[model samples]
Target: MKIFRRLLSYLEPYRIFLIVSLGAATISTLVALGPPYLVKLLIDQVLIQKNLPLLNYIILGLIALYLLHSGLTTLRIIYVNKVQQGLIFDLRNEVHHHLQRLSLSYFEKRQSGRITSRVINDVETLQAIVSSGAVIFTIALVTLLGSLIILMRLNLKLTLLAMIPMPAITFLVVMFSKKAHRRYRQMRRRLADINAILQENILGIQVTKSFRREKLREEKFIHKGEGYYQANMSVIRIWSVFFPLIMFASALGTVIVLYYGGREVIAGNLSIGGLVAFVSYLGLFYAPINQLNEVNNIFQHGRAAGERIFEVVDTIPEKEKKKAIIPPSFLKGKVEFDKVSFTYEKGKKQKEVLHQVSFTANPGDLIAFVGASGSGKSTIVSLLPRFYEINSGSIRIDGYNVKDFKLGYLRENIGMVLQEPFLFDGTVIQNILFGRPGASKEEVVKAAKIANAHNFIRQLPEDYETEVGERGVKLSVGEKQRITIARVMLKNPPILILDEATSSVDSEAEILIQEALEYLMKGKTSFVIAHRLSTIRNATRILVVLEGKIVEEGTHQELLEKESVYSHFYQMQFKENGKIIAI
Candidate 1:
C-alpha cells in the first residue's frame, strides 16, 4: 500500500487528469454491468410475461448502455495514459535530482548498472501497472460486486450454489500471488545481473580486446543472459499452472449454476427466462474473477520494481557534501586538515583505515604528499574536495571549515587532475569547456596553449573540434593527460590537486607536460600526490603520508638532508628510474 501511494504521489501535480480518469472508470464499470442485467430483465419481465413493446424498449436500452460503456472506457484509458506519462516524467526527474544531490561515496558503494536499471526499467514497469493493470483491477471489483448484488436478488439458492467454487478460487489466487511475487523478484534480480554484464563489458571493451579475452567475455555474457531466460521461464511455468487453474475455477461456478438452475426450471419452481437471467449474472460474476487474477500478476511485478527503485530514491544522500549551497565567487582556497581521520568502516569500530592526521596549506603554496600504495595519499587529497568526510576531525578552507561551508563552493574553487583522466565523447573544445562553462573561445585557446595541447589539437583534422571518443580513447595517453591539464587550467581556481598527473605518457611527453604543470602550479595553492619524486622538486613543502598520518614533513632540501622516510623514498625512486628527481 505504501509503495502504491508513493507511486501515486508522483501524479500529485496532475490531479485534475486523475480525477477525470476516476470518474470515467466509475461510469465505465457501471455501464459495462448493464448488458447482463438487461439480459436478465429481458428474460424475466419482457419474454416470460409476453410484454412485446417492453422487450423493444429494453433492447434499445441495452444498445445505449453498451455504447456508453465503450465511450467512457475509451476516455478513461486516454486520461489514465496522460496521468501515467506525467507520473513517469515526474518520478524520473525526482530520482535524477536525488542522485545528483548524493555524495560521491554513495556512487562508490553502489553499482552504476543497478542504479541505471532502476531509473530506466523500473519506471517503465510502474508506468504499465498504473496505465492498464490498476484500472482493470478497479473495474473487476466493481463488476464483481454489481453482478453479485443483482444475482442474489434474483434467486438466493442458485447464487449460493454458484459461489461454492469462489473460496477455492480465492485460495488458489492467494497461493499464486505468493509464488508470482517470489518469481518476479528473481526475474528482476536476473535482469539486473544482465545489465551489469552489459555495462561492464561495453565500458571495458578496450581492455577485453587488448588482452584477447573476447571468448571469455562472450561466455560470461551468455551466462548472464541464460540466467535471465531461466528466471522468465520459471515465472512462465508458474503462470501456466495457476492461470489455467483460475479459468477452471470460474468454469466450475457455471457448471454448478446450470445443474441446479436447470432442475429448478424443469420442476416449474423457476421459469426458462428466469434461469436464463441467472446464467447471465453468474457468468458476469466469474468473468471479473478471471480479470482480477490477471491484475495480481501486474501487482506482483510492479511491487518488485517499486522496491528496487525505492531503495535508491529513499536513501539519504551522503553527509560529506550535504552542506549548504555556496556561491562560486566567495571561495578563496587555503586548505587545512585539522586532525582529520577517516576510516572505511565495517560494522561500528571493528575495522578502520585512517588514524588522526593533520596538515595545512596556505594560498599560492605547492604542497607535495608522497607515499606508497594504500598509505592513504589519495585519501588525504580526496578529503579537501569533500569526497569523503572526516570521522573525527574537520577540513577547512580559508579559516571556514569545509563541513560548515557550502559543498559547491569548496569543490568549485578546487581544481583537480586525477591519475586516470576522463574525457567525455565530444570535441576537445567541449571537454575543456566543461571545466569553465562560460569560458570564451580565446580563453579556451589560451589555456590549451599553456597546457601544451594547442599544438597537437591544431594538427588534428578537425583541430579543437576533434572528437575525443569514449573516455578519450581516440587520443594517446599523453594527449588525454594534456587535455585534462588544459581543462583545469581553464578553470583557474585558487587551489589545485594533481593526483599522479604525470604518471602516464612517454619520457619526452613527461618533460613537455612537466613544463605545463609548472605553469599551472604558479601562484595557486597546490597539492601533488605522486610516487615519482621528479614532479615535486619545486614544491614549497613535502609531506610523507603513511597509514593515514603525516609521518614526516619538511622542504625537499631539508628532507634530503634528514635520511628519514622522505630520503629513503627519494633514493628508491632515483634507483628505479636512474635519475635523482628533486636534486
Candidate 2:
C-alpha cells in the first residue's frame, strides 16, 4: 500500500485532470441506470395499459440518455489517458536523472539490463492501472451501489435473495489476488534475469565467437527463457482457476433471484414488470462486482512494478557537497597524496588494495608509475580523481584537499586516456567535441593535428563526419586511441593521467601516440602508468609499486644505480627484448 501511494504521488501535479475524469465517469455510471428503469416503465405503462400517446416520449428519453452516456464516456477516456501518460512521463524522467547522479560502484554491482528494465519495462506495467483501472473501479463501485438501491425499492425480499453469493465472491477475489501478486512479482524478476543475460551476451559477442562458444551461449539463453515461460505459466494457472470460480459464485446469485421472484409473481405479491426490472438491476449489480475483481488484478500487477521502480529511485545517490569549494579556472596541477589507503570488498571480507601509498608531483613534472598487474598502479591515480573515497589519509591538489573541491570542478581539470578507448556511436567530429562541447571547429582540427589524427581523418570518405559504429567499431584500435588522445587534447586539462595508452597499438601507431603524449604532457603535472619501461626512460621521476606499496623511486639513472626494484624491472624487460644492459 505504501508503494501504491508513492506511485500515485506522481499524479499530484495533474490532479485537475484526474478530477475531471472522475466526474465524467460518475455521470456515465448514473446515466447507465436509466435504461433498466425505462424498460420497466415501457412494460408497465405502454404495453399493458395500451397507452399510445406516452410511447414517443419514453422512446425519446431513452435515446437521449444513451447519447449523453456516449459523450461522457468519450470525455472520460481522453482525460484518463492524459493523466496516465503524464504521470508515466514524469516518473521516467526522474528515475533516469537520478541514475545519472549515482557513483560508478553502483553500476559495477548491477547489470545494465536490470537497471534499464526498471526505467522502461516496470514503469510501462503501471499503464493499465493509471489509464483505466482506477476510474473504472470507481465507476463500478458507484454503479453497484446505485443498482442495489433500485433493486431493494422494486422488491426487498428478492434483493436479499440475490445477494446470497456476495460473501463467497468477495472471498474468491481476495484469495486469487494474493496469489496473483506473488506470481506477478516472480515473473518481473525472471524477466529482468533474461534481460541481463541478453545484454551480457550482446556486449561480449566478440569474445564468445572467438572462443566458439555460440552453442553454449544459446543454451544459456534458452535456460533463462524456460524460466520466464514457467513463471508466466504460474500466473496463467492461477487465472484459469480464479475466473471460473468467480463466475460460478456470481451466477449463483441470479439463480437465487429467479427462484424466489417467480413465486412472488405467481402469488401476485410482485407485478410482472417489477420482477423483470429487479432481474435487470441484479445483473447490473453483479457486472460491477466482477469488473472490480478484474481491476484488483491490475492494481496488484502495478503495485509489484511500482516496488521495483521506487527501489532504484529511493537509493541514496553519490554525495555532492553543495557548499564545496570551486577550483580556480586555470589550475597549477601540483598533486600530493599523504599516506592513502583503500580496500575493495571481497564477499564478506575487505581486501586492502593500497597501503599507505604516498607520492608528490610538482607542476610540469612527468611522473611515471611502473608495476606488475594488480600492483595498485592504476588505483593510485584513480584516487587523485576521487573515483573512490580513500579509507585513510588525504589527496590534495595545489594545497586544497580533493574532498573540499566540488566533484565537477575537480574532474574538469583532469584528463584521462585509458588503454581501451571508448567512443560513442556518432560522427568522428562529435566524439572529438565531446571533451569540450563548445570548442570551435579550428580548435578541434588543431587538437586532431597535435594527436596526428588529422591526416587519416581527411583520407576517409566523409572526413570528420564519418559515423563511428558502436564503441567506435568502425575504427581500428590505433585510430580509436588517437581519437581519444585528440579528445583529451581538446580538453587541455592542467593534469593528465595516461594508463598504458600505447600498450595495445602497433609500433607506428605507438610513435604517433608518443609524439602526441609529449605535446600533451608539456607544462602539466602528468601521471603515466606505463607497461613498457622503455617509454618512461625520460620521465622526470619514476615510482615502482609492488604489493600496493612504493618499493623504489628515482630518476632513470638514479634508480639503476640503486639496483633496487626499478633496476630489477628494467633488467627483466631488457632481457625479454634481447637488449644487453649493465645494472
Candidate 3:
C-alpha cells in the first residue's frame, strides 16, 4: 500500500484530469443502470398493459440513455489515458535522473539487464493500475451499491436470499488475492532474470561467436525462458481454479433469486415485471463483483512492478552537497593526492585496494603510472575526478579539495580516454560533439585533425556524418580510440587521464594514436597509465606503482639509474624484444 501510494503521488500534477475522468466513469456507470429499469417499464407499462401510445416515447428514452452513456465512456477513456501517460512520463524521467546520479559501484554490483528492466519493463506494467484498474474499481463499487439498492426496493426478501452466497465468495476472493500477489511477485523476478540473460547474450555475441558457443548460449537462454514459463504457469494455475469458483458463486446467487421469486410470482405477492427487473438487477450486482475480482488481478501485478521500480527510485543517490563550491573556470591542471586510501566493500568483507598513496603534478607536467594489473593504477586516477571518494586524505585540485568542488564542475575539467572507448549509436559528428554540445562544427573538424582522425573520417562514405554502430562497433579499435581522443580534445579540459589509451590497437594504429596523445598532452597536466615502456619514456616524472603504493618516482632515465621496480619493468619489456628502449 505504501508503494502504491507513492506511485499515486505522481498523479498529483494531473489531478484535474483524474477528477474529470472519475466523474465521467461514475456518470457512465449510473447511466448503465437505467437499462434494467427501462426493461421493467417496458414489460409493465407498454407491453403487458398494451399501451401503444407510450411505447415510442419509452423506446426513444432508452436510446438517448445509451447515447449519453457512450459519450461519457469515450470522455472517460480520453481523460484516463491523458492522466496515465502523464504520470508515466514524469516517473520515467525521475527514475532515469536518479540513475545518472548513482555511483559506479552501484552498477558494478548489478546486471545491466535488471536495471534496464526496472526502467523500461517494470514502468510499463504500471499502465494497468494507473490507467484502468483504479478507475474501473471505482465504477464497479458504485454500480454494485446502486444495484443492491434497486434490488431491495423491488423485493427485500428476494434480495436478502440472493446475497447469501456472497460471504463465501468474499472469502474465496481473499484467498485468491493472497496467492496472486505472491505469484505475481515471483513472475516479475523471473522476467527480470530473462531480461538480464538476453541483454548479456546480446552484448557478448562477438565472444560467443568467436568461441563457437552458439549452442551453449542458446541452451542458457532456453533455461532462463523455461523459468519464466513456469512462473507464468503458476499464475495461470491460480486463475484457472479461482475464476471458475467465482463464476459458480455468481451463478448460485441467480439461482436463489429465480427459485424464490418464481414462487412469489405464482403466489400473486410479486408482479411478473418486478420479478424480471429483480433478476436483471441481480446480474448487474454480480457483474461488478466479477469486475472487482479482475481489478484485484491487475492491482496485484502492478504492486509487484511498483516494488521493483521504487527499489531504484528510493535508493540513496550520489551526494551533491548543498554547500559544494563550483569553480569559476577550469583549474590550472595542478593535482595533488595526499596520503589517500580506499577500500572496496563487497558484501560483508572489505578489501583495501589502495594504501596510503600520494602524488603531485604541476601544470604542463606529464606524469606516467606504470604497474602490473590490479596494482591500483586506475583507482588513483579515478579518485582525481571524485568518481570514488577517497578514505583518508584530501585530493586537491589547484588549491581546493576535490570534494569541496561541485561534482559536475570537478569532472568537466578532467578529460579521460579509457582503454575501452565507448561511443553511442550515432554519426561520427554526433559522437565528437558529445564532448561539448555547444562546440562549432569547425572546432569538431579541427579537433579530429589534431587526433589524426580527420583523414579516415573523410574517407568514409558520409564523411563526418557516417554512422558509428553500437559502441562504435562498425569502426576499428584504432578508429574508435582516435575519435574518443578527438572528443576529449574538443572538450579541452586542463587535466587529462589516459588509461592505457592505445593498449588494444595494432602497431600501426598505436603510432598514430601515440602522436595524437602527444598533441593532447601538450599543455595539460596529464596522468598516463601505460604498459608499453616506450609510451611513457618522455614523461616528466614516472611513478612506479607496486602493491598500491608508489615505490619509485623520477624521470624515466632517473628511475632506470636506481635499478628499482621501474628499471625491472623497463628491462622486461625492451630486453625481451632484444631492443634498447629509448628514454
Candidate 4:
C-alpha cells in the first residue's frame, strides 16, 4: 500500500490532468445510468400505451445521452494519456540522472542489463497502471457504487439478497492478493535475469563466435528463458482458477435475484419493467466487480515494479564533503604521495593493492613507473585523481591535500590517456571537442596536428566529420590511439597520466606517439606507466614497483648500475629484442 501511494505521488505534478480526466470519467459513468432507466420507461410506458409521439422522443433522448457519454469519454482518454506520458518522462529522467552520480565501484558490482531494466522495463510497468488499469478501475468503482444505490432504491429486499454472495467473492480476491504479489515480484526478477543474459551475449558476440561458443551461448539463453517461462506459468496457473471461481460466485447472486424477483413479479408486487431494470443493474454491478479484479492484477504488477525502481533511487551516490575546497584555476603541477596505502573492497573484505607507496614529482618533471601487471602501478596514479580514496597517509597536488580539493575541480586540471581508447559514436571532430567542449575548430585541428592524427583524419571519406563507430571500431588501433592523444592535447591539463598509452601502436606509430607525448609533457608534471624501457630512458626519475611496493627508484643509468630488479628487467628486454635503441 505504501509503495502504491508513493507511486501515485509522481502524479502530483500532473494533478490538473488527473482531475480533468477523473471528473470526465465520473460524469460519463453517471450518464451511463440513464440508458437502463430510459429502457425501463420505454418498456413500461411507451410500449404498453402504444404512444408514437413519446417513442420518438425517447429515441432522441437516448441518442443525446450517448453522444454526451462519448464526448466525456474522449476528454478522459486524452488527459489520462497526458498524465501517463508525463509520469514516464519524469521518472525515467530522474533514475538516469541518479545513475550518472553513482561511484565507479557501484557499476563494477552489477551488470548493465539489470540496471537498465529498472529504468526501462520496471518504469514501463508502473506506467501501465496509470495509463489504462488505474483509469478503468476508477470508472468500474464508480459504476459499481452507483448501481448498488439504484438497485436498493428500486427494491431494497432484492438488493440485500443479491449482495449475499459478494463477501465470498471479496474473500477470494483477498486470499489471492498476497500470493499474486509474490509471484509477480519473482517474475520481474526472472525477466531481469533474461535481460542480463541477452545483453551480455550481444556485447560479447565477437568473443563467442571466435571461440565457437555460439551453441553454448544459445543454451545459456534458453536456460534463462525457461526460468522466465516457469515464472509466468506459475502466475497463469493461479489466475486461471481464481477467475473461474469469481465468475461462479457472481453467477450465484444473479440466480438468487432471479428466483425471488420472478416470484414478486408474478404476484404483481413488482412491475415487469422494474424487474427488467433490476436485472440490467445486476450486470452493471457484477461486471465492475470483475474489472476490479483485473485492477488488482495490475496493482500487484505495478507494486512489484515500483519496489525495483525505488531500490535504485534509494542507493547512495558518490558523496562530497560539505567543506571541500575548489582548487585554483592555475595549478603548479607538483605531486606528492606520503606513505599512501589502499585496498580494493570485495564485498565485506578488503584486499590491499598498495602498501606504504610514496613518490614525489616536482613541477615540469616526468616520472615513470615500470612494473609487471597487477603490481599496483595504475592504482598509484588512480589515487592522485581520487578515483579511489587511499586507506592511509596523504597525496597532495601543489601544496593542497587531494581530498581537500573539490572532485570536479581537481579532475579538471588532470588529463589521462588510457591503454584502450574509448570514443563515443559520433564524428571525429565531436570526439576531439569532448576534451574541451567550447574549443574552436582551429584549436581542435591544432591539437590533432600536435598528436600526429591530422593527416589521416583529413584523408578520411568525410574528413573531420567522419563517423567513428562505437568505441572507435571503425578506425585502426594506431589511428584510435592518436585520436585519443589529440583529445588529451586539447584538454592540455597541467598534470597528465599516460597508462600504456602508446603500447597498442606499431613501432613507427610508437615513435610518432612518443614525439607527441614529449610535446604534451613539456612544462607539465607527467606520470608514465610503460613496459617498453626504451621510451622512458630519459625519465627524470624511474620507480620500479613490485608486489605493491616501490623496490627501486633512480634514473635509467643509475637503475642499470644497481644490478637489481630494474637491471634484470632491462637485461631481459634487451636480450629479447637483441638490442636497446638509444632514444
Candidate 5:
C-alpha cells in the first residue's frame, strides 16, 4: 500500500539479480577488509621478522586479493545496473498501461508536460534511488558495521574513542536528512511545473507568434524558471550544510583516535601495525556516513514520483458493474439516452450541461446534434464511448445498458473522430492503419482511397512510408483530417461519432470529406456534431440543444417547418446567401 512497496513491485522480475548483487556486494565488502589486515600482517610478521625472501610472495598475494576485490565489485555493479534498466522499462510500461485505460476526463485535467515528466524524469530519478544509491548504501552500511566489529575486537579502547563522534553525527544526519527531503520534494514539484509551462509554450508556439506575445511568454517562462532555480538552490543550501557537518564530525572522530592512540603507542599499549590499520579504516567510516546523510533526499524524490504514478493507476476507473441486468452478445447500434442529466464539477455553478437529455437512434440512422459553444453537443457524443459518465440516467445500446458490456468490447465497436485529427509520427499508411491494428496493406490502402487520401499520399516522395511528422504537422490540416477519416473507415465499427470532423479543413476539403462521410455514414448508426449546418443538412435527425436540454428535434425539413431553434440556425446561413433553401 505504501509508495515504496508499490514501486518495489516493478523490480519483482529482477529478484534474482538483486539477491545476487547484494551477495556479491557483501562478499566484496568483506573481501575488501582483507587487504588492510594483510598489510598489518606483512608489517607485524613478515617485514618485522627481517625476512626479505618472503617479500616477493607477499606482494604477489596482495595483487591477487586486489584482483579478487575488483572482480567482486564489477559483478556487483553489473547486476545493480541490470536491475535499474529493467525496472525503468517496467515502470514506464505500467505508467503507459494506466494512461491508456484512464478516462478521457482525466487527461482533460492534466498537462501533457507533467505526464511526460512523470514518465521520463521521475522514472530516471526513481531508478537512481532504487538501483545505484540503494545498493551502494546497503554495501557501505554492512562494511561499516563489519569493520566496527573487527576494530572493537582488535582494540576496544581505541575503537570506542574513534567512534565517539559517530552518534552525534548520526543524529545530525537524521535531522538534516529530513530537512533535505522536504527541500528536494519541493525541487521536483517545481521542475514539473516548469516542464508543464515549456511544453504548453512549444505546442502553442504558432499562436504566441501570431499574437505577438513572445516577450510576454518569455517573462512567464522566466518566472517559472526562477521558481525552479530557487527550489534547486534550497536543496544546495541543505547539502552545503549537511556534507560539511558530516565531514567535520568524521574528522573529529579521527582526530580523537589519533590523539588518544598516539599516547598509547608511545606507552607500549598499541602495536604499530594495529595503529596503521585503525588509521586506514577511518576513511571507510566516512563513506557510509555520507551516504546515510543523503539517503533520505534520494528517497523523498522517489516517493514523490511514486505518489504521482499511483494517483493515476489507483483512480476509480469508469464504473462497469458485474452481473449485468441487460446483456447482449453483440451491439446492434441502437443507442438511447434516457433522462440523462450531466454536469461537469468545475463548470460554473456546477451547471448541468445536459439536463434530462433523451434521444434514440435506430440502426443506420444519421443523428446529428447541433448547438452553439457550451451547449453540450460534443459532450453528448463523448458519452456514447463512455468518455465521461452520465450523472443521472442510462445509456443503452440494443436494449442493453452500455455499462453491461466490457469496456474494451464497447469501445472496439465504436469509431470516433475528433475536431483536431491527431496522427502519430509515422508514415501516412501507418497512421491510416492505426485505427485497425494488424490490418493488411491492402485494407489500409482501400480505406485511404475511400477517405480520398490515397491520391495525395502517393504523390509524396516516400508515399506510404513518408513520415507524418509530429502530430502530422508535415501534412496540411485537410490531409491530416482525411488520413484520420481513413483510419476510422478502416476500423469499420458499428457505431460512429464525428465531432466537427470537417470543421478544421478548408471549404474544398470539407466538400471532399463530406463525400467520404456520406459513404461512411451508410449502414451504421452515426452521431455528428457540427457548427456548419450544411455538413449535417442531410442528417436523418437533428437535435437543437440549449442550456442542457433538447430545445428542438426533427428532420431538417420538419424543424425548419416549425421555425424554432433549428430554423434560426438554418435561416441564418440561408439569409447570408440572400436565398432560403428549405432543408
Candidate 6:
C-alpha cells in the first residue's frame, strides 16, 4: 500500500489529465445505468401497455445512451493513457539523472544489467496500473455503490440475498492480493536476474566464443530462463484458481437471486419486469467486482515493479559539503596526500585498501608509482580527483582541501587517461571533444597531432569524422589509446594521471605514446602508474607501493641504489627484458 501510494504521488503533476479521465469515467458510468433502467421501462410500461410511440422513444433513448457512454469511455481512455505515459517519462528521467549523480561505488556494488532493468523494464511495468486499469478500478467501485443503492430501492430482500457472497468475495480478494503481490515480486526479481545474465553474456560473447564455451553459456542462460518460466508458472497457476473462484462466487449470487426472485414473483409479490431488471442490475454489480479482480492483478504487478524502481530512486546520492566552494580558475597543481586511509566495504567485513598513504607532488613534478597489481597504486592517484573519499587525513590541491572545493570544479582541473579507453558510440571528433566540449576544430587537430593520432586519423576514410563504434572498436588499440591521450591533451588540465596507459600497445605505438606523454606532462603535476619501470626512469620522484603503503620513495636512480623494494622490482623487470645497462 505504501508503494502504491508512492506510485500515485507521481501522478500529481498529471492530475489534470487524471481528473479529466475520472470525470469522463463518472459520466460514462451514469450513462451506463440508464440502459438497464430503460429496459425495465420498455418491458413493464411500454410493451405491456401496448404504447408503440413510447416504445419507439425508449429504443431511441437506449441507443443515444450507449453512444454517449462510448464517447465518454473513449475520452477517459485517452486521458488515462496520457497520464500513464507522462508519469513514466518523468519517473525515468528522474531515475536516470539520479543514477548519474551516484558515486562510483554504487555502480561497483551492482551489475550494469540489473541497474538498467530498473530504469527500462521495471519502470515500464507501471504502465498498465496508471492507464486504463486504474480508471477501471475506480469506475468499478462507483458502479458497485450505485448499483447497490438502486438494487435496494427496487427490492431490498433480493438485494440482501444477492449480496450474501460479498463477504466471501471480499475474503477471497484479500487472500489473493496478499499472495499475488508476493508472487509478482518474486517473478519480477527472477526476470531481473535473467536480464542480468543476458546482458553479461551479450557483452562477453567474444570471450565465450574464444574459450569455446558457447554451450556452457547457453546452458547457463537456459537455467536462468527456466527459473523465469517457473516463476511465471507459479503466478499463472494461482491466477487459474483465483479467476474461477471469483466466477463461482459471482455465479452463486446469480443463483441466489434467481431462486428467491422466482419465488417472490410466483407469490405475486413482485412484477416480472422488475425481476428481469433486478437480474440485469445484479450482473452489472458483479461485472465490476470481476473487473476489480483483473485490476488487482495489474496493481500487484505494478507494486512489484514500483518497489524496484523506487529502490534505485530512493538511494542516497553522492554527498557534497554544504559549504563546498569553487576552486580558483588558475590552479597551481600542488597535490598533497596527508596520511590518507580508505577501507572498502564488501558485505559484512571491511578491507582497508590504502593505509595511511602519504605523498606530495609540487607544481610541474613528474611523480611515478610502481607496484604489483592491487598494491593501491591506482587508488592513490584516484584520490586526487576525489573519486573515492578518504577515511582519514586530507588531500589538498594548492592549499585547499579537496573536500572544500566543489566536486565538479576540483575535477575539472584534473584529467585522466586510463589503460582501457572508453569512447561513446559516436564520431572520432565527438569522442575527442568529450574532454572539453567547447574545444574548436583547430585545437582538436593540434591535440591529436601532439598525441601522434592525427597521422593515422587522416589515413582513415573520414578522418576525424569517422565513426569510432562502441568504445572505439573500429580503431586499433594504439589509435584508441592515442585518442584518449588527445582527449586529455585537449582538456589541458593542471593535473594529469596516466594509469598503465601504454601497457597494452606494441613497441612502435608505445614510443609514439611515450613521446606524446612527455609533451602532455609539461607544465603540469603528473602522476604515472606503470608496470614498465623504463617509462618512469626520468620521473622527478618515484614511489614504491606495497600492501597499501608507500614502502619506499625517491628518484629512480636513488631507489635503485637503495637496493630495496624498488630495486628488486627494477632488477626483476631488467632480467625479464634482458637489459642491464650502467645503473
Choose 5 or 6, whichever is better by lDDT. 6
Candidate 1 local lDDT, 124-173, one digit each (tens): 88777777777887788887898899889889999999988888899989
- Residue ranges of candidate 4 with Cα displaced over 4 Å: 49-52, 471-473, 574-583
Q: Where does candidate 4 have its weakest 10-residue lDDT segment? A: 574-583
Better of 3 and 4 by TM-score: 3
Give TM-scores for every candidate, taking all chains together and pairing residue i with residue i.
Answer: 0.91, 0.94, 0.95, 0.94, 0.93, 0.96
Q: lDDT tens string, model 3, 1-583?
A: 8878887788889999999999999999999999878888888898889998788887888999999999999999999999988878887888899898888988988999989888887888876797779798989999999999999888899999999989988998899999999999989888889899999999999999999999999999999889889999999999899988998999999998899899999999988889999999999999888889889899899999998888888888766778987676658988898999887673455777888888889999999987778788998999889887677888998988888888888888999999988888999999999899999999999999999999999998889999896744388999999999999999999999999898788889988999999999999999998766576788899887777888889998898798687677567766576322332
The reply for model 2, stretches above 4 Å from the true place, is: 471-473, 575-583
Residue 466 lDDT in model 6?
88
Q: lDDT (CA) for every model shown?
A: 0.82, 0.86, 0.88, 0.88, 0.81, 0.87
* Segments of candidate 3 deviating more than 4 angstroms: 471-473, 578-583
Model 1 lDDT at residue 323: 46
| Top-scoring candidate (TM-score) | 6
- Give me the runs in candidate 1 sitting further than 4 Å from their true place: 40-63, 320-329, 346-351, 471-473, 575-583
Query: Which residue pairs collide, candidate 4?
Result: none
- Per-residue lDDT tens digits for candidate 6, residues 1-583, read 8887888788898989999999999889978887888888888888787778988899899999999999998999889889988988998998999999888999998888888888988888977788857888889988888898889999999999998998889888888898898889988888888889999999999999999999999999899889889999999988899888988998999999999999999999988889999999999899999899989989999989988888888888877888986567689999999999987673456788999988899999999887778888898888888888788989989989999988888888998989887778998899899989999999999999999999999987888998896744377788898999999999999999999888788889888998898889999999998655566787999888888999989997888787687677567666578332222
User: How far off is model 2, as Cα RMSD?
Assistant: 2.5
The C-alpha RMSD in Å for every predicted model, in order, reads 3.0, 2.5, 2.3, 2.7, 2.8, 2.2
> How would you encode candidate 5's per-residue C-alpha lDDT over 92-117 as one tens digit per residue?
88777888777777788888888887
**Please, what are the lDDT tens digits per residue for candidate 2 over residues 1-583?**
8976886788888899999999999999999998988888888888999888788988999999999999999999999989988888988888898888787777888999889888888888876787768897989998999999998888888888888898999899999888999988998898888898999999999999999999999999999889989999998898889888888888898998888888988988987778888889888999988788889888888888888988888887876677798667788999999999887553446788999998899998999987778889898998888888788989999999998888888889999999998888898999999889999999999999998899999987789988885844378888888899999999999999999898888888888988888888888899998765565787899888888998888898998897587678577765487222222
**Candidates 3 and 6 compared by lDDT, better number:** 3
Clashing pairs in 6: none
Q: Write the per-residue lDDT of candidate 4 for residues 1-583, one digit (tens) a residue.
A: 8887887788999999999999999899989988888888888888876777888888999999999999999999999999999999999998898888787777988899888888999999988889778788889999999999999998999999999998999998987787899999999999998899999999999999999999999999999999999999998898898988998999899999999999999999998889999999998999998888888989898889999988888788766667987557699999999999888793456677898998899999989988878888898998888887678999999989988887888888899998888888999999999899999999999999999999999999889999896844389777888888899899999999999887777888888888888888889999998766565687999988888999889998898897777788677675577332221
